[model samples]
Target: MRADARKNREHLLAVAGAAIGEQGVDVSLRDIARRADVGLATLLRHFPTREALLDALLRTSFDGMAVRAAGLEASGEPGEALVSWLRDCVVWTTEYRGVTVLMAAAIEDPGSALHASCVTLRAAGARLLVRAQAAGVARGDIDGADLFALVAALAWLGDQPSLAPRADRLFGVVASAILTGAGGGDVEGAPPSGRG
Candidate 1:
């Protein structure tokens, strides 16, 4: 694209990101254009569809997670790296309300604009899980899809006003379930004791 057009696209994405952060994924496209001080037609010309716009806005974050996965793989222990990345994914999903629904759909629809990025992020998480499992830290019974689902489920807990307070504790329970030999003699759904 031309330099000015590229800059304009970047500006639109920035505005869209802020708008979505404030109002969520279902925020009006027209409102995004207005926030960017551009005509709706201009925004449409650049992004054409809501999914396309969301794909553009979220692509960088997805890609960044992949890079983070690589860094963790190189420097962190398998189980710790996997858990850390999973925690980050859950936190990020909660940041954009209603995004877990979109991501869940996009992962299943190969034709969607967000599909490729979602797949890439899942693959990154899968790699981490496999590493952990190989080290006998994480449960081998689960796979990448399971880990992805856990991220969505954990994010959902954070999204609910009533459940948000317990989200952190539930996360530990889920993590313990995923990680083998994590905490001993633990009750299911009980928060891990701060021992050993």
Candidate 2:
């Protein structure tokens, strides 16, 4: 692409990411075009579909998470690294209000433009999970699919306005449950002791 065309595409991507973060994935493409000061045709030329735009917008974050997971696995304790990455995954998935739901659906549909990115994201988490499990820190019964659902559930909880304040506590409880040995003490749903 020409320099000007590349500039226009980058501008559109920046504006679109902001718009989606604020207004959600359902935000209008026309509105994004307007906000970016680009024509609808230009937006279309750059991103042929809404899914394509979303894929572009989220690809970097997913890639970053994968790299972060690899680094954590290399440097940190297995259990701590998994918990830390799970927290990051919650933040990433809930950064945009409605993006969590879109990601959940996209991961299930191979035809979705975001499927490849979602798969990569899940694989990253799965790698950490395997390490933790191999270290006898995580439950052996659980697998990548369970971890994916756990992340989505935490993201959904974080998305709700009323529940947002408790998201961190809830995340901790879930993480504890996953890490606790089989037949260990029951996991409490409430916030851990000493935390508000």
Candidate 3:
């Protein structure tokens, strides 16, 4: 890309990220363009569709989480690795209010721009769950889909004004339910403060 074109794309991404963080997945593209001080046509040229823009926004986060999960998987006991990664996933998902809904939909739609990244993220979580299950530390009944759903469900709680305060506790409850012998907040490699 040309220097000026790359600059425009970066600026648009920054503006769109802030807008989506505040207004969620449904934020208007026109508003994003306005915030970036560009015409909507320029925005469209950069991101042909809303899903394309969202894909650009969320792909890095999805990849980062996958890398984090890999690090957690290699750093500790299986159960702790799974639980710690789960906590991080839920917290990250909660940061973007409505992205989980799109993630869920994208997971089932191969043609969607975000589908590949979402699938990779889910696979990363699934690997952690599989490792834990193999170690007999996590329940055998639940699979990767269940684990991913738990993340979406927990994140949805964070989006709710009424239930937001309880999200952290609820995450603990869910995380504990997944593990055979570990407390969610007390996982071996988890942060001491236990934000989730």
Candidate 4:
């Protein structure tokens, strides 16, 4: 593709990504083309089908998460990095609510790009989970599959804006309790104050 054509394609992907990632898979490509200031033909040339476009959008999000996870694995302490990764996952799910639905659909329908992304995500998440377990900072029995399910549940909070922030807080509280093997922050029901 020519330089200008490639630029237009990239622009279209960005616009389509935000729209579909937010609105859902049902978003119209014509609107995406208009948002990107490109013609219909150019959009179709880049993504032949609506499924292909949704797959690309999901792949883009997954690829970004993979990169961030890789970076966390590289430089951060194992337990700390795992916590950071969990926090980031909640934030990402909140931003792209449609992703949870897309992931579920992909799991039922094989040969999907979203399925490939899920595989990669599982591998990456497993690595971090193993590291956290080794450090005795996470549940040893927590598998990657379970974590994926939790993330999907977390995404459901996005449907209700009033609950999203509270959900993140509750997730953090529960995750910390699981990591520390504590219950409701002791009998007094107050979180222990520390430099953790």
Candidate 5:
């Protein structure tokens, strides 16, 4: 890329990151272009679609999440590392409004630009999970896919206006169940039943 073009792309990415972080993924592309002092045509030339823009914007964040997961695993107890990482995943996924939904779709769609990044992030979580389960802290049956789904679900729930207030509590309950084996059976599906 030419120096001027690269500069424009970087500026656009920075402005878009801040706008989406504050307002959401739904923030207008025109608004982003205006904020970056670039024309709509320039923005379109740089990012042909909303998904492309978002994929570029979030790539660094996803890489950071993977790095953090590795650091957590190295420093903390296996189970605690997994739990702590999951909490961070929730925060990371919801940093931009609608990011969690985008991530979920990206993970399922092989053609999505974000799919590779999402897979790397999930693999990071899976590494911690494998360690936890081997240490006899996490449930044996659950896998990386399960952990990824749980993190995405928590992030989605955390983003909802009605559920935001209770999201922390929900995380606690779910984390406890995953860590302590208090609730028997699959952690990925339904909540455990109350004893009579």
Candidate 6:
């Protein structure tokens, strides 16, 4: 692709990602094209199908989280690293609200390009979860699957028609539950003990 064409493709992906994620998959391709100041043909060339576009958008977001997670490894304590990465994930999810729905749909149909990336994301998440458990910051009983579910739920929350004022509070609840110590006997939906 020409430099300009590449730029257009990236722009369309970014705009469509935010718009569809904030709105719904029902958002028109024409609208995305208009917002990107590109012709519909250009958009189609980059993202032949709506599913393809969504998958690309999701891949882009996951790639970002992966980079952030790697950086957090050396940032501070392991538990703190997990908290930082989770906050970053929440911000990404909120930016792309309907992403969880896309994820589910992709899972239901593995032929979709999004499925592989989703699986990769799951593996990456598991690594973070395990690291926290090893650090003794999180309860050992917290399963990796449950942590992934929490992330999907958070993405669903981000997809809301409007941003909830309690976005931070919700994140806090999630972080606290995952950050409890073994002796604390699992926070499990409880608020932070106000000690850490």
Please identify which of the two predictions, 3 or 6, would achieve the higher lDDT against the true structure: 3
> Any runs in candidate 3 off by more than 4 Å, and if so which?
182-196
lDDT of 1 by residue, 1-196 (tens): 9999999999999999888877778999999999999999999999999999999989999999899998888887787788788877888777777788999999999999999999999999999999888888888899988888898888878877788888878887788788886522232443221110
User: CA lDDT, every prediction?
Assistant: 0.84, 0.84, 0.85, 0.68, 0.83, 0.69
Off by over 4 Å in 2: 181-196
| Deviation from native of the Cα of residue 106 in model 1, angstroms | 0.7
Error of 2 at 182 (Å): 12
**Per-residue alpha-carbon lDDT of candidate 6 for residues 1-196, written as tens digits (9 for 90 to 100):** 7998788778888899767755667799999989888899988989998888887777877787777777776566777777677666656665554566777666556798888877766666667778888878876887656766777676565555354544556767767777876423322332221111
Please say which candidate is ahead in lDDT: 1 or 6. 1
Candidate 5 ranges beyond 4 A from true positions: 181-196
In candidate 2, which residue pairs get closer than 3 Å at backbone N, Cα or C atoms, i.e. clash?
A: none
Per-candidate TM-scores read 0.90, 0.90, 0.92, 0.80, 0.87, 0.79
What C-alpha root-mean-square deviation, in Å, does candidate 1 show against the real structure?
A: 4.8
lDDT of 5 by residue, 61-151 (tens): 8999999998998888887788878887877777788887888889999999999999999999999999888888888888999999998
What's the distance in Å from true for residue 141, model 4? 2.0
Q: Least lDDT summed over 10 consecutive residues: which range in candidate 3?
A: 187-196
Cα lDDT tens digits for candidate 4, 1-196: 8998777767877898778656766788898888888788889989988878777766776888888888888877676676667666656665654667777667656787678888777667667778778777677778877777666765666446676545645666656654644212321222221111
Question: Which candidate do you rate higher for TM-score, 4 or 5?
Answer: 5
101 in model 1: Cα distance from truth in Å?
A: 0.2
Q: In candidate 4, how many Å is residue 81 off?
A: 1.2
RMSD of each: 4.8, 4.1, 2.8, 5.7, 6.2, 5.2
Off by over 4 Å in 4: 181-196
